[model samples]
Target: MSVLVLNTGSSSVKYELIEVESGERLANGVVERIGEDAGRLAHDGGAVEGRFADHEAALRAILDVLGDISPEAVGHRVVHGGEHFREAVLVDEGVIAAVERLAPLAPLHNPVNVIGIRVAQRAFPGVPQVAVFDTAFHHTIPPHAATYAVPPEWKVRRFGFHGTSCAYVAERASALLGSDLSAINLIVLHLGNGASATAVQAGRSVDTSMGLTPMEGLVMGTRSGDVDPGLAGYLARTCGIDADEALTRRSGLLALAGVSDMRTVRQRADEGDEAARLAREVYCHRIRKYVGAYYAVLGRVDAIIFTGGVGEHDAEVRAMSMAGLERLGVVLDPARNQAPSTGERAVSEENGEVAVLVIPTDEEWEIARQTLQSVRRGAPQLGDHA
Candidate 1:
């Protein structure tokens, strides 16, 4: 059976059509710059670049390209399900409302994600659409770890993101160790345009870096992670800047080095740019602190896992992030780490206490797999259209 996976962002939609059983991607492409002057959709091994006015039109055109594949199910990567959704849910009017209700919690994600789901529901009416959340797997965190030091009535608590990637990477790390996942302690670092670290104890997420929002953890592409909470009020008063826009947009590596891409930062650092150098140090330092913090939390760690864009592709960041972590049983071998290996594999020294690994994340495959299962296992079986 085939399942179509859609991951819609505020201005972009990434899609993949997969053959569920074999886990092979049948078709995949991205629609970028949606609602902007230069929006485009790249699909069927070709790219079309132009202006896409809204998500509805973008998805409709995407389906038009897919034609009559008759996917068994549709899966969407919903960013924050809060405490409401713990697993993939079959979309209905009720589900849509439920997702929309949580948009305030994920201002940049949920609303746009709802648009994707609604558009899909219209184009492929009745085809079961499932939402697999990025916050679901981290739901295993205990109350203490998930709770914030805020007033109980305020309803603030940690809701970790990038869970699907962590789930897939944690399983892959277990396989490489030749051990049961439940028997080992692992630290998962998911670094991309966004980044966060998760402490997995015996196959469950006991603690993670992100708290309440994606902006509260390790340094990220455009968001400043772990700034003093009061800085918002201070910055607003002193710099006359809106706190939300400042923290979410004009911050993090972008603010530190004037660039969000790590490659560019590294390049400038290579050329002796002091700001770029400090940005790298700050980024790696934040990761190291989480490692130490999680090590204390996990008590014992079997593996230090890295995944996502920067984690898998940038060996330099991996090495620097784990630098001086050897005393805590984390050690990386230069040759193995620098070796051009792909898929999931280890890069740690032979006798290292914590096995450092690179597990390439496959969120689309995970979404497709979960989508098919969500449909067959419990979703009402009506027709392909539904």
Candidate 2:
């Protein structure tokens, strides 16, 4: 079976066509800058120039690139599944309505995800569409971990994001260590534009840094993580900050260093830029705090896995975050950490008690894998290609 995985954002659409049974990505690319004067589609074949005025237009352009190839099933990345959806499910009218009802929870993502689903439905009529949620994996999080200290009437809980990535990397980490996933504990740091730290014990999430929204976790490119509950009201009373918008759009490394890209921040830090240097420290420090907290939660962590853009590529982040944690058996081998490689490998000492690894996240593959499972019930783990 082949699954087309679609992740629709406000201004872009990321897609991948995978041979789900074999876990081979047959085609993949992104349609970027929708609703802008300039738009581009960069795919396995190369780049194509065009203007995508909307999600429907982008979907049409994608079909043009795909030509005769069609998907048997489609897996869509829905950011917030809320409490109702515990796993990926076949989509229908009820699913779309439910997703629309939960839009307030993920104002920025779910709406666009629905847009992608509608468009994909038109493009691939009669095909099954599966929603692979980003919050579903953390549904196993216990009340003690997921519950916020507030009135029950508020009806808010920590529904962690990056679950597709988490599912992919955790399985790969277990594979790399040659251990049963159910036998070891792990701390997975997914550092990208949106960052999160999850504590997985015995192959299930016990605790995670993100709470209710992606904006509550580790410092991200532009999202503020772990601000005081009172800060928003205080800022509103004083500086008239649109706390919600500012926190999610104009904070983190962007607010601290005047830019959000980790590469740019690191570059500036290297050149003795004080603010940029501080941004790096703040980012790493937040990660270290989560590592230490999760260490206590897990009791014994077998490995620390790093995935996503910054986590896999930024050697300094991997080093600084693990620094002074030797007592906790989390030690990074300097040479290994600095090695230039995109493939999954350990960056920890040869005989360290806790392994530190960088596994490039394959979320689309994970989604396709889950789509297969949803469509064909007893689907086994895909081939050991990664």
Candidate 3:
């Protein structure tokens, strides 16, 4: 049996088909620029470009490409499950309603996630669909770390994002160390377009950089990671800018270096651009601070695993973030750090107190595995395919 995982964004849908037993990816692809003048669907070494009008059309196009592949189950990557969903759940009307109701927490992501679920339910009826949340893995964070010093009536607390990637990489890191996961302490830095740092103690999240939303963590492509709380009000009063829009869409690397992409920022910095240079400093500084903080939280970290786009591919970022951290038992070998390699490998000195590693995250496969488990546990089945 194969499980199909769908990760839906505002204007994009990424999917993968994985064999449930072997965990082998059979096919994977994405539909980009939906609801725009020009949209494209690329799948299994082929590309289809057109003006797709909506998400439904994009999903249908994906199904058309799948042709004869009939996945036994479907998995969705829901951004925010809130406190209601502590784990993956079977998609029923009630679950759908709950996901919709919780959209205020993940305004930009959960709705599109629901759209993917609805479309997939219609396209592959009778197939069990599971909602694998990004926040679920971090639910194990202690109340002291997850809670904020806010009014009790407000009910606001840290709801860490990127738990899916953290979960996958933590397991991979444990295997790479040849150690028992429950005995090892780790700090997982998922540095992607949207970044987060998680402190995993005994295989559970003790603390995470992201708080209440994805925008609270490390500096990201467009989101400002940890700005002063007062800055929002300050922006509103002085600049007439909505705090949410500015922080979520107009800030971070974009506001700092005038470019959201890290590669471009690094290139400009290499050319002696002061702004880009400062941006990289700020970014790496934040990461180092979290690494130190999480090390304290975990007491003795067995490994510091770097994953995601920037963490896995950017050698400079990996090295720069760990700079000056040698006293903390985290040291990087310059040769190993800059080595051209792939998969899971250590970049730190041999026999270092704390192992530094770069592990590629596979969230899609993780989602598919979770979905398959949920299905086998007797999740409610749907009707025939639409």
- Highest lDDT: give the candidate number: 2
Query: Quick one: ranking by lDDT, best first?
Result: 2, 3, 1
Could you give the C-alpha RMSD of every candidate to the true structure, in order shown? 3.6, 5.0, 3.6
lDDT of each residue in 73-161, candidate 2, tens digit only: 99999988888777888888778888888877676678888988898888889998888899999989999998989999999999998
> Which pairs clash inside model 3?
159-212
Q: Could you tell me every candidate's TM-score relative to the true structure?
A: 0.90, 0.91, 0.91
Model 1, runs deviating above 4 Å: 10-12, 31-68, 379-386
Model 3 worst lDDT run, 10 consecutive residues: 377-386
- Return the clash pairs for model 1, or none: 39-50, 126-385, 126-386, 127-385, 127-386, 128-386
Error of 3 at 343 (Å): 1.2
Candidate 3 stretches with Cα past 4 Å from truth are 9-12, 31-42, 45-61, 379-386
Clash count for each candidate, listed in order shown: 6, 1, 1
User: Distance (Å) between predicted and true CA of 136, model 1?
Assistant: 1.2
lDDT of 3 by residue, 56-83 (tens): 7888888888888788999999998888
lDDT winner between candidates 1 and 2: 2
